[model samples]
Target: SDQRTAWLPAFLAYYNARRPHSALGYQPPASRIPGNNLLQLNS
Candidate 1:
């Protein structure tokens, strides 16, 4: 459980920041946020 707790936040971060969603036209959720420099770097 401690290990799961430690990794859960990391997994959620990746899910919202890097994983593409079909409903979002295959773009990560972070890409939709304004001024997200990571999006520009990825593109």
Candidate 2:
């Protein structure tokens, strides 16, 4: 429980901001959300 609480924020940020998903055309879910910010991935 302690570990989960400690790591949850970091994990959620990664999951929402960095981790790419196939269902999203191999892009991170965050990129799809309406926002001015952009993330660039180097191939």
**Candidate 2 residue pairs in backbone clash:** none
User: How close is every model to the real structure, measured as TM-score?
Assistant: 0.68, 0.76
Clashing pairs counted in every model: 0, 0
Per-residue alpha-carbon lDDT of candidate 1 for residues 1-43, written as tens digits (9 for 90 to 100): 9999999999999999999999999999887877646566568
Model 2 misplacement above 4 A: 36-43
Per residue, candidate 2 scores C-alpha lDDT tens digits across 1-43 of: 9999999999999999899999999899988865754533422
Give all candidates' CA lDDT scores: 0.88, 0.85
Worst 10 residues of 1 by lDDT: 33-42
